[model samples]
Target: MSDKGLFISFEGIDGSGKSTQARLLADHLRDAGRDVILTREPGGSPGAEEIRALVLQGDPDRWSAETEILLFTAARRDHLERTIRPALAAGKVVICDRFADSTRMYQGLSRGDLRGVVDRLHDLMIGVEPDLTILIDMDPTEGLSRALSRKGAEERFEDFGEDLQKAMRAGFLALADEFADRFRVVDGARAVDDVASDVRAVADGFLPKRRV
Candidate 1:
């Protein structure tokens, strides 16, 4: 936890139901009377949202791996300054849809062998890690199928297709191992509620007791 607040992030390959689960967890915590701020990366603040459209839309090759790294870092800086840090300072529970780990996988491993670049930039610009990161693990084939069905405009990463999704799945799992202390892997292959139930259970173990 940072600044007396609980910071939680959810991650998985695209269409792995992480977004839905993040929202559900936010709702659950709110019902339990915790102050919660649910937001997403690359778009939590206005400035970052603009950058999000640039990076998340258009062709998959819209930007080179090196260039995407800079753009994402900039967006994250603004997001941290304007959204995440302030929420934490207020002692609210911050549930993010995706965070730096997504960049570590997408731009770091997926596009090229530039993980060092991503890490260096992150350490320099935004140095905060979530208190807990919930990784919704799913089968790549199933995840890709679900992602394509969305037909959303922010499908640039999804447009990379199944092989990338498979790679992302493996990379994310490796990341969980690397950051094992804070990463919790939940099976996303199950029904949404079942997955959420597991996620809630995992989160409860980390959450502090409610204030009197």
Candidate 2:
């Protein structure tokens, strides 16, 4: 953890409601008069957003697994420089929708054998992990159903189908175990408000109280 502020990241399979939870947490923290920045990846800063469009749009196979990993790392570096790091330096609670964990799961899943490559690249370039990471766990079938209902060009990942999503879910759960110190698993199958409240409480425990 940084000495100045909280860096909380929300991580989960697509449609696990992690994105929504991240947003709600940011809002809740802001309401308590905390300095907060809500951002996301593949694109959080300008350069990252451009990279996001490239990665998330176009045909599903627009980039090969190795190339996709490189692009994601590039965007993440830009995000760390232009957005996340600076905000933390200024003593703001920075809530990121997804971080390197997504890269690990998505890219590693691509080749199954490429996970080592992904980890090595992350260590070589983007070495920082969030101070706290919330992993929203959900049933893949339900998550896929929700994900498909949303219309967007970003449907490239969703097109991978439920089996892949289930595998990803297991991967994410495994990650929570692997990085237990900084990761918390939340059941995303619950009601939104229930999940939101749980998220708020968990984050509140980690954050320092605002000064009068």
Whole-model lDDT per candidate:
0.95, 0.90
Q: How many times do residue backbones clash in model 2? A: 0
Q: Model 1, poorest ten-residue lDDT window? A: 203-212
Cα displacement (Å) at residue 82, model 2: 0.5
Encode model 2's per-residue lDDT on 31-91: one tens digit a residue: 9999999999999999999999998887777888899899999999999999988998999
Residue-pair clashes per prediction, in order, are: 0, 0
Off by over 4 Å in 2: none
Candidate 2: deviation at residue 58, Å? 2.0
TM-score of each: 0.99, 0.97
Candidate 1: residue pairs that collide = none
TM-score, candidate number 2: 0.97
- Evaluated against the true structure, the overall lDDT of model 2 is 0.90
lDDT (0-100) at residue 196 of candidate 2?
Answer: 96
